[model samples]
Target: MYETLASVDWARLQFAVTALYHFLFVPLTLGLSFIVAIMETLYVRSGDEKWKRITRFWMTLFAINFAIGVATGIIMEFEFGTNWSNYSWFVGDIFGAPLAVEGILAFFMESTFFAVMFFGWDKVGKGFHLLSTWLVAVGSNLSALWILVANGWMQYPTGMAFNPDLFRYEMASFWDVVLSPVAVAKFLHTTGAGYVTSALFVMGISAWFLLKKRDVVLAKRSMVVAASFGLIVSLYVVLSGDESAHQVAQKQPAKLAAMEGIYEGEKRAGIVGFGLLRPDKQIGDKTSPFYLDITIPYALSLLGYHDINAFVPGIDDLVYGNAEKGIRPAQERLDSGKIAVGALADYKAARKSGDAATATAALDTFNAHVGDFGYGYLEKPEQIIPPVTPLFYSFHMMAGLGFWFLLLFTVTLYLLMVNDITRHTLWLRAALLSWPLGFVASELGWVVAEVGRQPWAVQDMLPVHIAMTDISGSSVMITVFAFAAIFTLLLIAEVRIMLKQIKIGIEGGH
Candidate 1:
């Protein structure tokens, strides 16, 4: 069992698993807290004891989730030094800046208010408490936004200077990192996903109450709120997904290729919601293991290029053809061309005097790779490239989850509309329980999105490989295992607590 497992990059493996567990709680925490806040506000305004009870019930669950999320999330920062040291060093100046701000600004605000909102319910005035809750909500979202800004920089780097002296990339403009296209799109997409998570969570608990014939009024109201939010957020997610896909196609075409399993340029590419990708050894095999592929050619055309007939490159076309000719070689050639004759002469002279033999080998290797006579060439900066395997799978996983979530939401919502949400106790229960799926989907979406662009803290600019330090794999493996074990226990405890809270809420325990 462990033999094949050893082949896995234990460090990366641990990080992904740990993060996934942490994220299960995050979206719900972000979106549900706001919904909960709204419920409490309604209670405050209307003086309805039911809404207050509902808020308290949800608050119990939120507290459980928040604790576990924080517990699992904190270790990740440390892992940057222990496991991803290289990546940290390479893009630290640029990457660290946003994360620091997130900690100092957003994280601090959220954490501070969160404690008060949880414990200060009676101690603080109703108005003050409500204000704190909303601030906490805003702080949570703000935290997400700023962190995503840093992440967006990774996906599409902007406003950075290449300092030869530092031998690494640094942020020249903080504003650019904050407002990158990647950041903006991800923010929309992620926030929308969070709303879905919250909706599903409320729906599940409300369904449970109906099943037990308990608190009919509370259950009905919860379902109404959940269904409404779900409706809006699901729509937003669909639109955001489209916009994000277009951006990915434009900025990270290879990722798009992998997501669609397209191997060549096609005027009309099929949009697939579910299908098996049998990576044919051949360039493009006639045989496919496709379970289902729904194609809407005009839609793809309209979305991608505002025309159905416009050609979109397939995976094969992208990876084998365009990637080399269109992206890689062209950039490399341009970069190679940028080396000045004077610079080359100066380097050679310095090398000759310093250590002629070693210098000659180094120069020869670099010149061969660079392709020019190593002089009089003007090269644009190298495009930041992600590690191949992680980037490939993560991008596809994110896309897969997006399509799956859409289908899940659509079917569940349909059932709710047709069958009367509270009446269909079993379906409602399923919907209520589906909260984890929604949460996981959002989390995985983020993971794939952020990790897929690895090696580049910034697109076409900073590289992750250079950021790492010369650390032992064993050290990383040890910490990864330790965290994995600890996080696993915490996750189990969180689930148990959440389930208990839901059971109590549905039973009108409050």
Candidate 2:
């Protein structure tokens, strides 16, 4: 038991470290590509050499981020084989398809057009060059879309059926997987956040220029573009976030309960406006667990269900059950799961002994309750629950930062429109200082999403500890430290290069 626990923790830590590092570069790529496209478009429309220089400068930064992001991304693919081989095989049929399409279609196109957007500035026609830049932007987002689709499937696990014969899940409908509501919502929210990150980045640097009294014309123009763009998309991100929350309520109630820090079932649960989630709390352990909490009445009910009167299940309700809320006791699922697991063992034994008829009969019974297969491994309902501490705080941090971004962009947009940001030194300095908030908000949002769904690698279908490959704990621990060290070195190199380029200023582009 100790060895198993240690292995799971080490493997999870390794993957989490890799994922967090990779994401740092992704949002910038998402937002900067379009910003670069917009700049290139302005250059093409006005035939202005200054606009051309501005476009080239941002594009150079975009290229650097893109290259580093890609390098870091490759390790995740390798991690799947090395650390998560069991999971890879279990749902390879369903999960592998989106990844395959992303590599063949989105990634190739992004790389191809990216070269043209860079070196072909002089070699290609002006029209073709502009087209290439737009293509790169589209390709970058398409890559995001497919990756989200794969991730969304893991969250929801729809459009697939378990295959007893193959002992794996197979795709039931490709389009269903591709067009999942969860996937669509995630794509919008994620890309929207990326755009927010880019806008903040541009606005911050432009604000820095204003403070330094350098390149007034270019800096003001950049600020206007970023402020306008950020305003519209920040609104979209919040809306999409609400939609995402609604979906989570429907599909992942335990995660929602954890995020909201709900301990007991209620008809009209309040949304926690501010709270310090106490460490000692657990499902069924506390009726009111918070150390400090401020709530907006019925807000959680309305936000999660779109119905003010709807009942929201708490952690205890999710673990045990609430008959009034239409929730079945988890023990019932566990009971059925044991029978199904036994049937699978019987089938395997019969097959080994060359009894075709017995194998077929046992297989039929196993398939009947295959949906509860993961439950069979658990001894009790508490085994289904994830760690609530990270989920609770991460959600708040993400939400708080999101609102701050909206206010920052809205105020900055107004200032840019009035063309009087130079008059407000404090506001300009705040903008320059607040560049990292977007990255913080973005990472926290992911932490809430991924950590909230803990225990399960594929929701209720597969637990991550069970799904991870059979590897020694020490080996995983060794690899975890190695990856952390290497990624830290690369990140330092990237930050230094970016700072040097930015320090050189707008003149560096020419």
Candidate 3:
């Protein structure tokens, strides 16, 4: 059992490393594509060679980031087959559909247009070149949309039915999966973060140029575009985040509880504005969860349910049951899930033995408790609660950084347009330093989303251990170290290349 767990842990670590590394580039790619398109559009409208120079300068950076992002993304996809074959087999019918569309349609379109956008500036007509750039941007976002749709389906597991005979989930409604509310909210919120990331990247670089007193006019214009774009999308991020929280409350209450460090169920739950979780806190303990905290009154209830007085269940409520809240205990689900598991085995056995009536009865029993099937694999009810400390910190950090980005964009924009932004040396320095925070916030948002839904590969349906491929622990461990080294080198290379380009300055632009 320990060996099995070790193997699973290694596999998880490997995937996490790849995923986090890959994501470091994804958000920037998503946002920078559109920003470059917008810049080129400006160049076309006014026939301004300065706008063209700005477009080309940023586009060079975007192209470098895009190439590395594609490489990492493709490697991450191959890991699904290599490390998570069981999960792939179990939900491939439902999950693979969106990925296929992303690869075949979105990725193809993006790749094709990206060439024309990058190389067609002088060779092609200005209008056609601008169209290609816009197409590339649209294609990049469409790729994200499809990928998020698949991920959101994992979180919610909607529009699918379990096939007992096949021992897998099959897609029941394509449109339902595509247009799922969870999918929509996740895509919008995630892309909004991406937009803000690119804006910060642009503003930060621009600020650096200003501080160095090189290309003052270009720096100011870039700052204005980035600040305006960042400020608007920052609002979208917040609004979409609220909807995401509400969805979590409705669909995955355990994750919501873990995020807030809630151990006892309550009405009118207050959100922790900033809190340090007590190291010794445990489920059903009498001790307070936090060491020191400030909480806004009823904010959690409002955010979770769009109501100020909604009852928010905690980790204890989810694991031990809250009869008053009509929440069933994990133990009950575990028992039911075991029964379902037994029924499935019995059904398969009876079918093999050519006993039709027995198989029918077993199938009926399995269907009755299929909702708790994943719980059957768990050793204890406590497993339902995710890592509270990580979720709590990740959620707060993401939220705090988000608000800061909004403020930075607002203040930066105000200063740029109305006042002389270049005069504010302190603010320029702050802007330059704050760009990395966008990447940090983006990563934390993913940590909150992915880590918050622990244990389950597909929420409520497939646990992570059960979903792992049957591979040796040493094999996974070796790959983990290997990938870590490779990804680190790739990151260093991209950074060095980008810095070299930035050092060369906009004078290098065509």
Top-TM-score candidate index: 3
The clash tally of candidate 1 reads 27
lDDT of 1 by residue, 36-132 (tens): 7888888889988888877878777777878778645667778777666656765778888878877876557988888888888779888988888
Top-down lDDT ranking: 3, 2, 1
**C-alpha local distance difference test of each model:** 0.66, 0.87, 0.92
Ranking by TM-score: 3, 2, 1
Candidate 2: the clashing residue pairs are none
RMSD of each: 6.0, 1.6, 1.1
Q: What are the clashing pairs of model 3?
A: none
Worst 10 residues of 2 by lDDT: 280-289
Give stretches of model 3 more than 4 Å off: none
Cα distance off (Å), candidate 3, residue 499: 0.5
Q: Cα deviation of 88 in candidate 1 (Å)? A: 1.9
